[model samples]
Target: MTSQEIFAQIKKKASFLCVGLDPDPQRIPKHLLKEKDPVLTFNKIIIDHTIDHAVAYKPNLAFYEAMGPAGLETLAKTLEYLPEEVFTIADAKRGDIGNTSRLYAKAFFEQMNFDAITVAPYMGEDSVGPFLAFDGKWVILLALTSNQGSQDFQLIENKEGKPLYASVLEKSKTWGTTENMMYVVGATRGESIAEVRKLVPEHFLLVPGVGAQGGSLEEVAKYGMNNQCGLLVNSSRGILYASAEKDFGEAAKKEALALQTDMAQLLDSYCK
Candidate 1:
């Protein structure tokens, strides 16, 4: 979707929430497992339940890739089932040389038709530029992530004292405009968000590490929000895996609604 379309959805739904679909087969409800494709069954139900409460859906590709062909089939089916109006992300942190990157872009944008894809920027411009060639699709570059090991590289100070992640933001912004580019700023890095925002004030941020990861939602919104509500706060385990019981979908929807309600309040303040 285009930036205008994305912002419109955020306004219409009163939500910037992105529900992460990191489904674990073992954790799925036994009743769902009885179906031929339990993962898709779980995703379809969850999508139906939370569609109105969220503006985006991110399916972590690793989770499905591990399940092999059947898992991939489920992933494809899940994509087909999602509503066209909502943004869809393949949380596949793919980055390669120019040729391979082009194929990766085709895989998600043309074949899978995901609205966005998570991209690792370690290989520099060529690894990410191919994905930017597609119009109306997003490349969510990994910056300071929520993981503990992120400090090993992302936090390292350069000769001029800028953090490695800061440099990544500065250098990569030229590869794509706000319409096709976004950076992943972990919710756990609440204080650093102000710094990251300065680097690319208008670009959308796909923020994970909330919910189960214990990142504070209020802190992220307070420091990270822009006039357009330029934040897609994500919750995975804390929402989708809220319950492994038969009522899992209902429970997931309840958790998502709570986040959406909180997001509505934040958006009101920003959009004012």
Candidate 2:
């Protein structure tokens, strides 16, 4: 989906929430285990419950990949189940050589039909270019991520004293328009988000680390929001594992509603 379309959904739903469909079979309710495809059942319930509250659904590939061949079927079937208007993201975090990257893009954008895919920028423009070549699909490049390990490389400074992520935001911003590109800015680093805002004010940010990871939603909005409400704050574990019983779906809905309620107020206060 284009940036305008995504923002439109935010306005319609009164939310910029992106529900992360990173399901762990072990953590899902035991009643679901009796089903033939437990993981898929878990995902369906989560999507069904949160659909009204979320604008996007991101399924991290690692969880499905770990399940082997059946896992891929689970992933494909899950995609088929999502509503077309609800944006989908493959949290693959893939980037390689030119040809390899092209294939990765085709797999997620063509075969899987995802609206966006997370990409690592360590391979430079050539690795990322192939993805952007596809019409309407998005490349969510990794920038100032929320992990503690992010300090290892993203914080390193060059001769100009600019951090590596600053360089990523500056240079990568030139490769794609705001409609087709977004940066993955972590919600934990609120001050860092202000720094990112200075670099690319118009681009959307696919922010993680909000609920389960302890990132402040208010802090993210205070510094990261723009005129378009350029943020897709994600909540995975908190919503997905809200309950270990049959009430899981209802619990997930409650958690998502609470976040969306908070987001509605943020949009009112910040989206000028």
Candidate 3:
């Protein structure tokens, strides 16, 4: 989806929530195992329960890939089942040589038809540019992540006195316009979001580390939001895995509604 389309959905739904589908068979209710495809079955329920309260759904590829060939088949089926209007992301974090990058783009954008894919920019523009070549799709590059290990490199200052992520934001912004490109700015780095915003004021940010990871929703919105309400705060473990019992879907819905309500209030305050 284009930037305008994405913003429109945010307004229409009163939300900027992205529900992460990092399903774990062990964590899911055992009763679901009786279903034909338990992973897909679990996802379908979660989607049905939370779709109204969320504007996007991200399926982390690793969770499915770990399940082996059966895992991949489940991922494909999960993609097919997602609502077309809801923005979809394959959290593959893939980056490779140009030729391989093109194939990765084709797999997610063509075969599975995801709206976006998270990419790693460690390989530079050529690795990321192939994904940008596909019109109407998005490349969400890793910037300042929320993980403990982000300080290893992303926070390191180069000889130019700029943090590695700052350089990344500046250089990679040229790869695509705000419409087709976004950066993954973890919500735990909330205080620094304003600094990043000054670097690329128009781009959207796919923020993780919100609920389960302890990132503040209010702080992220305060520092990261632009005229378009440019933030997609994700809550995975907090929402989807809210319950491992039969009430899983209902529990997920409640958590999503609470976040959606908060987002509506945030949007209203900003739109004013």
Candidate maximizing lDDT? 2
Candidate 3 per-residue lDDT over residues 91-141, each given as its tens digit: 999999999999999999999899999999899999999999989999999
Tens digit of per-residue lDDT, candidate 1, span 1-272:
88788889999999999999999988888888788888898999999989999999999999999999788888999999998999999999999999999999999999999999999999999999999999889999999899898889999998999999999999999989999999999988678998998899999999999978779888888889998878999999988888889999899999999999998998887654
Q: Number of backbone collisions per candidate, in order?
A: 0, 0, 0
Model with the higher lDDT, candidate 2 or 3: 2
Task: Look at candidate 2 and tell me the lDDT of residue 8.
Answer: 94
Ordered by lDDT, highest first, the candidates read 2, 3, 1
TM-score of each model, in listed order: 0.98, 0.99, 0.98
Compared with the true structure, the alpha-carbon lDDT of candidate 2 equals 0.95
Note each model's CA RMSD in angstroms.
Answer: 0.8, 0.6, 0.9
Model 1's TM-score against the true structure: 0.98
lDDT of 3 at 196: 93
